[model samples]
Target: MSTDAHPTPEGAQSGRGRAPDTEWRSWHARRLETITAPYGPLSLTGTHWLDDHPDGRIPAVPGVWVQDGEEIVLTAAAADGLTHDGELLSGSVRLTAHHGPIPESPLAHGDRRLVVLRREGLRAVRDFDPHAAARSAFQGIEATPYDPRWALPGRFRPYPEQLSVRVRSADGRERGLGLSGEVVFAYDGAERTLRAVVEGDGSLGIVFADATSGDTSYRFRFLRPFAPAADGTVTVDLNRALLPPCAFAGHFICPFPPPGNTLGFAVPAGERRLIGG
Candidate 1:
């Protein structure tokens, strides 16, 4: 592993600080490797909504999939060679939308599973084909190792009223980017805060970019600030920053950074670029 810190003009001022500890740097590197792996977010091929196919059949996916308002009806013959929850499935099953991890999805056929999903009444099916082209073409992710200066202690301040903003996604669609508060921290004596949306589990998500955007790193990156403590203290660890869905497949409707979310500063501390070779 390379412990060296390369200069990034975007966040150059912040990069001049001391890097994080060796153990933390190694952990950050390994995390990047796992996220850029074959089955990582970069490997996602498509997010097919059931509403697009009025006929219960999704293109390229062999199972009969239809959403029946509240539940998804998937019809597959025993010979279709699909699996559900790791077991071979050959019959019709009524499946509800899964809101958990992809690997633990309740529907599958062999290596291909029909994932049922719903967003604001619009139903969709995510096809996780292990043989996806993106998965095969994945070389690795370009990232910066952890630096203590980049992992600043932050405070979560909830808004008096929740804020929602509609932003254009990479797929040319508009989606609501909700914000409940901001996580404020300081780097190089300069205070910075990110507009964050609280998740169902109370975790916070920030869609942001820095000088490295469209230059060294992907256009934009995502950062998840773990749930705040009783005292509202949190750690904004840029080392664990992530690439958005649009970074993997073009089909994803990932929203861009809302106003004020994009820091004018350059963040030169986390995942830096994409290694395609």
Candidate 2:
């Protein structure tokens, strides 16, 4: 989908009418179920990078993990109590980073899944346990009551080509953020635009902040719009804005908003923070 040269205004009571309060409530309830799930972000306990431990011993985790080219070599003893696919593992095995759901990870230490992850060129292992402290202490997600005014019609304008910008991440590290286009919409009588990245599923992922950030809400939030129509028409719904994964757990390395993605106005909608935390 590509944006047209001229912006198009969608009627307030057109095909995409205001969503009912019950629908928004249901969405919020589902969000809670997802985040508090057993292997969700809240269950993550550690992100152990191999480079940080040259001795091949990960802190607090049994077994030795060493980076071997594009794969990782894990050496364990029977006493380590590590298993692979429910079988006890007492030797060495090579493993590649997992690309699917966390429950599908191969290595497990009791109830914890040792998930391999590769970011940029660095390799790391994430430990996820259902009984993690964060998961246990999770009260709920703080969000504003849904309002129709926060939902606006928008158009997606693709760039001539893809572009990558280096931005600071929540972990205090810099990483590349690939941008494919911008989503433009009218708000408060003015047109606004946000640089967005095309997700693997063809949706648009946006990380943004507003005047309410760091005050009434989190420092930044994320929004993912469905694939645009052939005419680049889409709904820019601020009421569905979400807190990044880092907001649920400190171990997650979520990226921050790219340059110019921060808005000058306040957006009092969507998720604010983890309740009581």
Best by lDDT: 2
Q: Against the true structure, candidate 1 has what lDDT? A: 0.69
The predictions' CA RMSDs to the true structure, in order, are 7.0, 6.0
For residue 93, give model 2's deviation from the true position in Å. 1.0
Error of 2 at 152 (Å): 0.8
Which ten contiguous residues of candidate 1 have the minimum total lDDT? 1-10
Badly placed stretches (over 4 Å) of model 2 are 1-19
Total backbone clashes of candidate 1, pairs 3 or more residues apart or in separate chains: 10
Model 2, position 117, has a per-residue lDDT of 84
lDDT (0-100) at residue 191 of candidate 2?
98
RMSD of 1: 7.0
User: Highest TM-score: which candidate?
Assistant: 2
TM of each candidate vs. truth: 0.81, 0.92
